[model samples]
Target: MKTTTTMLGLLLGLSAPALAQGLETYAEFPKDTPPGNIAIAPDGRMFMSVHEFYGHALRIVEVKPDGSTTPYPTDAWAHAPQEDGDGLNGVLGLQVDREGILWMLDGQGENQTGRIVGWDTNTETLHAIHYIGQPAARPTSFLNDLAVDREHGAIYISDTGDGANSAIIVVDLDTGRARRVLEGSQFTVPEDTPMIIDGREVKLGGNPAKIGINPITVDPTNTWVYFAPMTANSMYRVRTTDLLDTDLSDADLANRVERYGDKVTSDGSTVDTAGNVYITAMTDNAIGVTKADGTYEVLYQSDEDLPWPDGFAMGVDGFVYATINELHRSPVLNGGEDASLGTYRIVRFPALSATVSGR
Candidate 1:
């Protein structure tokens, strides 16, 4: 059987002497199991959503360090309940705020974008993206990833749309005013196009299959921006001062973006306190890590056995967390059912311990 280990070794990314990287897989699921996004709490708990995206089950599960998992309270918090289909209103994006609040991106699968939700890490208190930027166009344009600059009292969101590719939507976390910035910079799209995944190319519904910079991670010091098109293999960055200025014209901001070293064709990425980037790669099927020197390393190559690694996060004790969504062969990306989809996985590894949290 072709496993993550063999495939990774076949790709020539594995290090010699068996990588010392200590990664342990704590959980697995059966067919139709899809893990949306992952976030880590200071309390050492790992939180993630389930079900195929677009039509979320609105279910969030918390995984213990020892591999046990429990359901988070979605029934008590979801204000917009879903019916008709077995949908929990897909929970696509998740992040932990500076204050330890868990913010979730609820993307309704009815061809409509959904809401941003917040759960108090300490008290389990729930809050939506209220008083901040709401969806620009609901039920269609959905919320994606989130970057909270609590230092500045602002939250930045990515709006992935159907007709419109995407836009950077900012919310005044305190006042609730939402503003759209950088609308048309090789980023947003007006029509749905075809995208290629694995060895097959498929169109996501009618949505464009091209890359439009979906995943974003801020620099530890909040001085720079790192992002990539979920479909592309390279990563890019720009000074955070440029994007946050709000006064800079879209052209000016676009010009400020600096192309960082091409790490790998990555999907989701996160940095530790030490400025090391843990990026997921479909082609590599391993976490392509980039250090401060611009050199890179593949920390663990499928030792825990993953499929289409996607999300990255650093939890308590500076451990790395990742989700294997098996997106590479899905109908949304590939053209049909892929063996990769039958089971879902979450893998963890102890990354370099540094205090870098991208804002």
Candidate 2:
């Protein structure tokens, strides 16, 4: 609800159609830190991960209505020692379920283990902790994003592995067991594509970044899980039933995968009840959608290059909120020198139809 005078001035300058489409700045961060992913509670509370790529101190914070941020849950939990088994290691994905549980995905860096922590917001207590280690999470695994399937009692994670060994990790919430699937498969691996941003190729460690299987989301019905590689041109999906079927062979599971639609190089995505997948089209500096008919369209294109739209969260207010962190300019992606301009943003627009909050 806090709209700065500068943002209001920018809004006044937008074209009529852009305003009519409902795209507008929601909040802005004037600091050097960058936010990675966002999760909205049914009561309108906003939480975001301070991107690990930037090596910031705070891991996650709750963005207040006045555009200020405070350490989420508690300062102790946010800054707890990872080795002490009481804090978040590296979190980039989180969501709130129908029961008011905020599930956070912690990809333990260096340790190479991953775990999902569920916090009960309604009671302000710890709900559950499910560790994903060993064969389920490879040494090179970079657990990026996740989709919660409440109907199936599971959580699906995209392991953007060392590019070549990328896979989808399915975790059984009931038993805390995990299985890595689709390793080295075309659907999970990135294509030989270069991410061209601002007329230059984005690179990491002096090489073109080939990130794989970054965006993952489940439909409103929780029937299908849609995901795609960060550098791929197409989206792919599989039924939640098939993903939870442990009896199915790898080949059978691979055969079950289907091409969803065409998507530009993107980061975060969310689905509406009408079966539309809203994408953060980072390559185009725009927000687009893959409709029910499998056709894609640009819904909102910002006049100023949207730094890097990173994550999506469907709010109870009927708007789809996203974080714009300018990640491509991070020191890790750039040549060890941060090129990001301050005043990062969290933007929102009206959803095409009803969407599930905390998605």
Candidate 3:
């Protein structure tokens, strides 16, 4: 890992003035394709999933320091299947664990089933593949984001299932068993609030985007998993121990959920060692923090509308990197017209406290 001062100066070209201002542009991308989730490896390598909504040909890419991208792992794995063998299918949530294993959430697997792909960056080999289908996943299940709890040998996923049947799917890495918990519970369901951006209601398919349980993350110690619906005002959390317990019934697990703090409509989140939850406050065009005390504060606001601060990744360099893709302006949400300005960005700023690379 590079020192923070050297990284800010050499890699990002961030001046002292810019550092004080917050949210410096670290990288940029074209509007035709948008990045969904971001994951930074301990070695300072960055990876991102092409936002599934855009239907880009590339599912995942390794972003270089020069702002160029290459099909990650291999060209064959980054694109749709041509002949045979495995490839990433609609990957949204991805994180590089402490062991250098990149876990990708393939929400749209073959036949629209869901799966988790773990690739060991250290050995350059496939680590494991766990299929999350049937009773563990619903017909409308959109397995959006995931949190890798290395401490508990489990993976927690947020299945935003058509808003009505949203739930959390826990995958035991040791056994490759996935169990759906808290289905349709208040903790997983979205509130009635409408997502308003730029003073206009953001809608999808001519209806308010009532997305449920979008951003999911684990703390530095991997003790608690914090999450919230994309349209909700409050963030919720649960102990990893309870989530990994196979004996806990749906009702019993629901009782363990606790409201962590108040948050604005957000897309992604990551926690630090100090317990501050960094949120992509999309509605506010800023990055906000929910302190350990359960109080919220805006940490960095963009000069212009920041569009949608889609995902977050704490780099080894001590800065939190985020993707700024204008998702609300996409044709899917803009009534069949592309309203984007044709430029997207990845920005970074110093974290409030020391943090891990991937959350």
Candidate 4:
């Protein structure tokens, strides 16, 4: 299989090497449809967010073990209007909790306010829904990723603020109240650092997109929330307690932020039961894992074959699954021409040596 990928790359003029030993292609999307985000349910089932970014209709569907997909919840949730209770504008970051619940953050492509929807995967029933509109978000905000604290009954979201301001929005699950916090911290701002792929800086129309805090995850212990900006070389974390407290002054909460460690240009991340953090090394075209002691290693790497690795989710069956598509090679970034030469793929490898749980 590795040889096949390498051969394909060569034929396309890409100098990609063979995939690392254990990496395997789990599924592939047709050339017309590109993947957006992936999440794993507690029952070992996989779900993918299908959106209009790649010319596909908006929907969230389940990817079965044998490579079949069925619309999750229902087609109604996917195509519902913006004003309806169960309407879904679009889904970006998807997460499944330990209790078999599916959570989705819908950005709706900046035309409307974003909302978060939670559903019981087992029952296929709506559990909770909250709108992050006017008071909690600005029109320029891009609610990129999220970390759910089940025990604390809260959800922490990262606002990328593509053309506006950046901040962390903390939502109280019980009351559906969300407040923006830690606005304008260096941790949430785009650094001067540039993201490179295949030894060349990734640019959109000759200029790199200034992405802010995007990837976020909660440690197994639920004590800390870890996050990083797409343009940064370092990771930052803060106590969950401080983030949940609205009484803390912005300066005081900012003081609580602690630098986790240096990291590469990363997109998505999750921690294993052993407290090891696995991140998508977007620039290196691989998965990078950091130990509890702060050591980093390239867990899996492929040449140009993998493209820009994005979302990650650890399944109950003991493998971490990731969505890989040529995001940097898309027309929006690639001088008005589609550079994503082939099919988008989802790949997974054996999970870490132990169990991983967020609760």
How close is each model in CA RMSD to the real structure?
Answer: 4.8, 3.4, 5.2, 4.1
Between candidates 2 and 4, name the one with more favorable TM-score: 2
User: What TM-score does each of the candidates earn?
Assistant: 0.79, 0.92, 0.91, 0.89
Model 4 residue runs over 4 Å out of place are 1-19, 80-86, 108-111, 204-206
Computed on alpha carbons, the lDDT of every model, listed in order, comes to 0.61, 0.83, 0.83, 0.77
lDDT of 1 by residue, 39-117 (tens): 8765666787764542343377776655555667444443235444322355666778667788777665554445566
Looking at candidate 1, what is the lDDT of residue 328? 58
Q: Pick the candidate with the highest TM-score.
A: 2
Candidate 4 per-residue lDDT, tens place, 270-302, comes to 877776778888788887876677667776777
Candidate 2, residues 1-359, lDDT tens digits: the string is 54422212234433432321346778888664488899888778888888888778787888998888988777867764666656788899998887778899988677446889898888989999998897898888888999988888899999998999999999998989899999989999999989988777999778898889999999878889999998988888899999999999989999999998888899999988888888898877778888878888777765363677889999998989888887887888888877888648888888999777423
Rank order (by TM-score, best first): 2, 3, 4, 1
Better of 3 and 4 by lDDT: 3
Model 2 CA deviation exceeding 4 Å by range: 1-22, 80-85, 303-305
How many residue pairs clash per model?
21, 0, 0, 0
